[model samples]
Target: MENLSTIERILAAKQSLPGALLPILHDIQDALGYIPPDAVPSIARALNLSRAEVHGVITYYHYFRQTPPGRHVVRVCRAEACQSVGCEALATHVQSALACEFHATSADGDLTLEAVYCLGHCAVGPNIQIDETTLHARMTPEKFDRLLAELRSKP
Candidate 1:
């Protein structure tokens, strides 16, 4: 399959690097949106690690996803800083609004909502990241809906 070919290429390309597991996983995730379970054997063989090791690495990191993501990814900060600023309320709103919970895609598969520990913008707190690019701070339910509307409007 094409996924195997791509995975083989990535394994061949990065297998020689020092401390290659994390980078290899990152590259695969970047290219495929999520790491295919079938690719684990090839990756483990290339890295000279067991499938358990490979799977462990993937599971250890919050950033790694085992399945395909939705068209859009929405990450809301949940660190203590964000919590102080009412991020819990914001998170509740998001889950209710999208009818999706953290680490799960919406029913229509339009969006994925996740909880990120921190966005490094803790001073502002209550921050949200859209598709890992745009960052919004001091968010509220109203602002979230407006942003969601805008995203839905786009093709």
Candidate 2:
């Protein structure tokens, strides 16, 4: 299958590097969105590690996902700065509106909600990043709806 081919290529490309495990994992995730469960054995064999080791690395990192993400990834800042500015209420609204909890993709697969520690925009606090780009600062429930509507309106 194409996935296997891609994984093989990724492994071959990064296998020779020093301390290659993390880079290999990162590359795999970049190419496949998430490391497939089946990938653990192959990676472990290639790197001379145990499947448990590979899986442990993948599971230890918050950035690594075990499944494909939705069309959009919405990350709301939950760090102290943002919380001080009422990110909790904003978070509640997002969860309610999206009908999915943090780290989950919506049933419709249109959105993935995540809790991020910070967006480095504390001055504007209550920030949310959409799809790794487009940071919206000083967010409110109303702003979120309008933004969601705008995204949904796009073909």
Which candidate leads in lDDT? 1
Local accuracy of candidate 1 as per-residue lDDT tens digits, 119-149:
9999997999998689999999999999999
Candidate 2 per-residue C-alpha lDDT over 1-155 given as tens digits, one digit per residue, 9 for 90 to 100: 88888989989999889989999888888888788898888899899999999899899999899899988889999999999999999999999999999999989899999999988999998999998679899999999999998977776
Q: How far is candidate 2 from the true structure (C-alpha RMSD, Å)?
A: 1.2
RMSD of each: 1.0, 1.2
Q: Candidate 1: where is the Cα deviation over 4 Å?
A: none
- TM-score of every model versus the real structure: 0.96, 0.94
Q: How far out, in Å, is residue 47 in model 2?
A: 1.0
Q: Which residue window of length 10 is worst by lDDT in model 2?
A: 25-34
* Local error of candidate 1 at residue 73 (angstroms): 0.8
Clashing residue pairs, candidate 2?
A: none
